[model samples]
Target: MSLFPIFLKLTGRPCVVIGAGRLAESKIESLRAAEAAITVIAPRAIDAIAERADAGELILRARPYVEGDLAGAFLVVAATDDPAVNRAVFAEATASGVLCNAVDDPPFCDFYFPSVVRRGDLQLAISTAGNSPALAQQLRKELNEQLPLDLGDWLADLGNLRREVVTAEPLNESRRLLLHQLAQRHVCAYDQCPSRLLAREHARTNPIPMEKA
Candidate 1:
């Protein structure tokens, strides 16, 4: 089946995780990395999860899963080893219209967590539609090795230039093409760089009319 890939903005969103073992701990950490407001439900939690709760990084409920646990959650993760409990969580999540991922149980999951490689603001995610997470992880490792560590920093510079160009230029095909060319050829916005010089020349020669500005 084809998947519609997306990057969610989970900052300040409410997310629920069921179970607190080693597996649950990983899911919780991934949610936390996205700055989601997380609540973990489990009768027993691993040391890492307990410590995080102690530090007020997340809300922890020292209890087993219960009905209504997923209410109002934007997303839910069922990370328990118990297949019954995972299915139960998935049912409630489906009824409530919340996205749910039952780790390792694709049939009960609304989504699967992709293996990710992150560098600053850049993220590369690999997914195999829950068929083979190991393969996704292997691909992530390979891409991580091939990509330059400084690529994110260079993208940041390109972003700044794009913003400036948008503000200073008008809507036109030349402007659009110039932006694409800049991305392909520019490293950073160093004034001495050939690409940067070309950008400066374009802006200077094709200034927006006074009325348009």
Candidate 2:
């Protein structure tokens, strides 16, 4: 599948999950991490899902899903054990023009959840186009081990450096070279980056000369 991968901002957006089993719990947790306004529908939920409901993390409709459960939902996840129920959800979501993912069923899915390696804001997602989830997970594990832990902080620093250059430097090539040079110090082992300060100083001192157009 030639999927166009994207990271969606689901904060405060409505999301519906059509199951409350262990698999659904995993999907729900990922949604929670993205701060989506989640509504779960199932006749019964597992302990972890029940706990989340009790803690007010999500809204739980403790009953079998009805036809309109996905109404006005931005995204839907059908993680129920029953294939029939999952297919029904996929159909309804498709008809309503909502993005849907039927867990473990690639043909029924509009999207597939990738195995993710996260270090704070730095997240690396690995997907095998739903062809091999196990392979994706293995790749995530390998990347997790190889990638440095302080990468997120490094990225934040680099971002600040980039903004500084963009504000101070008028020449596009000068800004590009500075950004590329900063990218070379990736795979950060330490959180403290003295280069960020130096970069700011460089931006201030070496102002891009104006072109005599």
TM-score of each model, paired residue for residue:
0.92, 0.88
Report backbone clashes per prediction.
Answer: 0, 0
- In model 2, what lDDT does residue 170 have? 71
Best by TM-score: 1
Candidate 1 lDDT, tens digit per residue, 147-210? Answer: 9898888888888788878887887999999999988965575678776677778888789989
Model 1 residue pairs with clashes: none
- Candidates' RMSD to native: 1.7, 3.3
- What's the lDDT for candidate 1? 0.90
Best-fitting candidate, scored by lDDT = 1
Q: In model 1, state the lDDT of residue 150.
A: 86
**Given candidate 2, what's the lDDT at residue 131?**
78
Model 1, which residues run further than 4 Å from truth? 189-195, 210-212
For model 2, give the 10-residue run with minimal summed lDDT: 186-195
Clashing pairs in 2: none
